[model samples]
Target: MSYPRRRIIQTGGALAGATLAGCISVSDDSSDKNTSDDGSGDGKTAAGTAQLWHGRSKGPKKNLVTNVETFGSETNHSVKLSEISELEKKLENAIPAGKGPHLFQWAHDWIGEYQPAGLLSDQKENLSVDIDSTFTKAAAEAVQFNGEVLGLPWAAETVGLVYNKELVDKPPEMVEEMQSIMDEHHDPSNGKYGLSFPIDPYFISGYAQAFGGFYYDEGNDKLGLTNEKTLKGFRFVRDELAKYIPKDHAYDPQAAVFNEGNAPFAINGPWFLGSVRDSGVDVGVAPLPKPKGGTPKPYTTVKIWYFSKKMNQGGKNATAGRKFAEWHTTNTDILSTLAEEHGFIPVHKDLAGSDELPAATKAYSKSVKMGEPIPTHKHMSSVWDPLKSAFKKVVKGDQDAKPAFKQAEKTIKSNWQ
Candidate 1:
């Protein structure tokens, strides 16, 4: 079998099950804090404790509780960070009837799936977008669906150039510069090389976008990777860029090369900061250089703090709920704490003024501001595996880039079932 064909056939897997909502009524009690109505009962949390429904545990959970406690006194909304393993199912049943917490945290990609179902409110429905004036344009846009803002953008991450600062004083600003540095500094005999970016779709897709390419057309709802620009990018990576990549490479060895300083540059994201930092290498992080002024827009994943549509009823309780979300989401001190304590990428402006920025937080901010938000379309869930197999084949010289991508496109289109 062909390489991609064999890989695709060998890569059978399952997608996550769809979360379902049921017909559950709201509980009405005068003292049941998170009551179901707009204002019939006291708007306090259940038994005087406000809650934040999250899937996080341990360190993340502790950090959330600390931040919430900092501002919980502002609205008399004593809160706790509760781990709900069945988060989606529980929120689905609770929000409609108004028994859910004032706030919940989830990924921005789920905005499309939940927005149409009325689980969340427009960002401007209970609060003003003007308050979010500090958010990056990409961060602000990530919370929107159709034409309305869905929630407040929170922690985010995107791919960037992670380099050995000892090898390169500054990040290259263009593709030519990167190439020049590689040609001058790369020495295979000494275990020193210029670039160690793996030849994978997840990483290369960013460069493809920078060179004017996309896998799916957002507006047309169709595959968009067959164009000339995309082909140009593929050719560049497979031919010219391939020279910098070692042969027969896989993720483990590729990461080993960069971490060991055999290669100075790796295209990776903030999540890898811990591993890279622990390697004890002097590393520098910055946005991917624009090649010929082309944008190397990385894929960004955003975590949002959403207000429950059922909880914010435009009453005194609702008013307090909004204040709670604002206290947690918009406060400079709270945001800095999340950054310093949890390594979360703060979405607010003027983060530089804060003395608490972690090394990873500083490394991640620029790309998070400039990269593309991961698409929320349900079909996108089927995209990654097929593309991963194809990427390996193209870089190994086992298949041409265009044909590899075409085959993966067919697989994704059919695999969504």
Candidate 2:
């Protein structure tokens, strides 16, 4: 049957859920029954209003609101877009309470956790095929959970190496090349350095990735940070990379130096594009530096629309949700506007070819293509804080790579408990 759509949000992170909840009550309302495998999708047509939930405000939220309203008017379906704080926790509770929204917006990372919790709806094969053909290769692969397409991708982002075009005619292609650029230009006493990226887990991830490592392996559903390549990446960061970067340069300082034209190169994401532009420095975006055996690839995060279990059950709501997802993702004008106005890149491949793309986005596309989808496994959430701490320790020369890595892995394992 169908639902009456509205928004539900809770403000606290702790208001989440556990497994073993009761089943969703299937409505017995026969008047709205439209179950006939209408090719609209699954053999059921729910009769209620579908709620689209999200936690964003400003541009991203505005895009969703307009799309939701447009979808409703065109199809005569009842869909409401609402904003809620701590949306992830609200979803955790509402799904079990059978008062959940029919759809929601979230990052690619959450798909792993959501799937295990039975919070998402699997797409029809036809829809999955459409997604594959429409979205970027990296983004198309990222939305899947155990071979199932879990969401419709909207925006995609990954870090890139930003360099002053005035200082360097061409960006470096490999780590060694980056080092040479450093060797020739880095001089801390003169208020100049080769690179200005931070030494945290997030920043080092691209370097680690260049060495053939990742935070999690989807195939095995396990952490990969302690692998040989990853360990080498850590050592490289502490040994070779850190020496070029001045000590105590956090993210803000890294951007500041780059913005002030004191830095010839810096590793950053599209989000930093505005700052570079505002600084009035001509900048060029390039892919992360490649390592010896592998190409550099940054960790990519995808923004998407996830269909809830209720909508996947097939019915008017499912049809409406699918319709809305397609409209929001495929409309070229909307996607172009979103990418140009916001820092994130649209997943649509055509946008990459459009002359209308934001300058930063057009330049950053090469880096985005070289990037890997950030892991979505729930276990990955445990790796960040502890690993970043371990990373900082190694950077400071206070710890060895082996023990630091072991401690971080152990801490993550503990977090899994």
Candidate 3:
């Protein structure tokens, strides 16, 4: 894996699954009376309570809470970290009613919806440190909307090729190479597969992306389901790759084959690291191979700490939130822990290239860096199901790729209306 020479540093926090909405800063919420001025009322940021809401569960959730506790202990600030279920939906409701957290953690894709709705604080003015060069280019792009920085990127998640070293000595460099590997090992009757591939649109995106096709183009705010190149790519997956993949398109069956060491390659995300390790396979991570036309570009999601517009009300809550956000993002030690323990790909420029990172992490980070940030346009939410349905139809041989994509485009437009 290669890295950029000039390293940049910034502070932020990391991972989980959620969307953030509005917030109630100390100044805005009367019930949490932890606000206090430092006696010198010179307009300096005050020390007070910072309430954060997240939807992280499991081990990563515990780590987030523990990190918040550490922030409270060191700063003499009150940090209320609540792990709420259905947090993304609750945020959609809470933010407009002025009932969200001062700071919330979630994926960066929501920047388009929240920022445009005036629910998010434009961190350009409030951020304590410059982050222009802090994170990877893709990570930085994920948090920006209409030229404004909406949040600080903590980490990035994207899918890549995971292979068992015993089956393949080296990763494929091109789609042709991958196809040849598939042809050599594929035997459906024998319960063997060449590749363990999930049939979901998210996983199959690399095929379309490799052929210069995209589900949505954020810059143009246009959908591309029917694009000729994209259709060609989908056809490739259906006609060429699908035959080598397991008949059952579900994740578990595919993963089982790869985990049991029956399959050589699997296109998956960082989440698969533990299971592969537990299966005792000497796994190696690599970027998905290039198609004839272009390199594979998987969709990426950047996890970020968003400062809600309520934070703009400014007081102890905003101040403390900023302090903690900056500290958490920039602290290499904390990021390293998350990277090693949770399999998060740190977005920090320095940490991303650090020698301290595990070999698999370093290799996987290449794919994340190469990935395109998932479109943040509100319309993007409408694209997933239609594309997914189309993919299922193509893979199942019920429809051709071109017509399937054409129908998907129509359905998405109908949804948009």
Candidate 4:
């Protein structure tokens, strides 16, 4: 049978069924008889407008709004789109009051927080598309919570070792080599350092991960801050690397140190690629060197389009929202534009290996593959600050890794709600 052009999303394969509530309903046939394209359906109507909220107001990402408009025009649906600044806070407040949109765009890290609050919808039952084959494994895994797929992955990002080729011949393959380079170049008295790594948890989590530790395990709601493996990472950074890091750990200054050719290596994300190019640095990107303990695995964040509980109620809006999300995420053209124009790493398996991707993207993709998804457990929110505090103390030489991480784990457990 010929398929309706709009129903190509279901062509990814057969839909998986489960005895689960909160999943959107999908019909087997491509007939428009039961489906309404105009998003005007109330609870009882065939279709209603699909409302979406996001945080992209500027930069190349703003093109998402244009895409939404195009989707509306093409599908004959009424779409409501809003650009909100404080998306997480607004979503937390609006969803509970029953005033949230049908869909929201955000990173997969929030799945833990929203899914537990009963704000997100289980999407796998009628997803139709095979997530494992459509997106990168990491991206596909990021959208899952407690075995339920909750969103569609669109883009991927993670930190990597960014080096100035002018200053360094090649990126280090092991932490010992990296340390030697730092020692040879470091001259703290004259305001120079070997590297410009930030001490914050986001940047340092890789080291801990390399050593077989995590700040928190969302699956078991367990904290790993004080684990022996984690302490090894903290101690390694403090004793062997932190002294070579510049005093200013803020992003701008750390970037400046690298851009100005004062540092040979910097740990940063794809967002820093443009600035590096603008600064005329011959940039080289590589996966972080394997630490003595294990391979470095940074935290990766996947940008996702999540179906809200509001959309899961099943109606025109739900159908419209699911259709738009599946189409936007799976459309090779849209994903290609996101990667080519915006420097975003495409999570789609088809585009990721394409030779057409920018060189920087190709390099970063290696690092992204080596990384792990940031935990999506709601309690993860309580882990960041405490870990940062412990990290700061360790880096500043005020406290040893054991006590600092001990305190951090204690605080995290106490604050976990």
- Measured over all alpha carbons after superposition, the RMSD of each candidate to the real structure, in angstroms, is 7.8, 8.2, 7.2, 10.3
Which structure is stronger by TM-score: 2 or 4? Answer: 4
Which lDDT tens digits does candidate 1 get at residues 17-67? 312221111222234343442433676433234446765523455566566
TM-score of 2: 0.70
Which 10 consecutive residues of model 1 have the lowest summed lDDT? 6-15
Q: lDDT for every model? A: 0.64, 0.69, 0.75, 0.72
CA shift of 10, model 1, Å: 26
Error of 2 at 124 (Å): 3.2
Window of ten residues with lowest summed lDDT in model 4 = 3-12
Q: Give the clash count for each candidate.
A: 1, 15, 7, 8
Q: Indicate the worst ten consecutive residues by lDDT in candidate 3.
A: 3-12
lDDT of 4 at 344: 72
Question: Which candidate number maximizes TM-score?
Answer: 3
TM-scores vs. true structure, each candidate: 0.67, 0.70, 0.81, 0.77
Better of 1 and 2 by TM-score: 2
- Which segments of candidate 4 are over 4 A away from where they belong? 1-50, 56-66, 69-81, 123-128, 146-148, 179-193, 218-221, 259-262, 278-282, 313-320, 341-343, 353-357
Candidate 4 lDDT, 272-304, residue by residue in tens = 666676678888877788877587778778888
- Candidate 3 local lDDT, residue 369: 67
On lDDT, the stronger of 2 and 3 is 3
TM-score, candidate number 1? 0.67
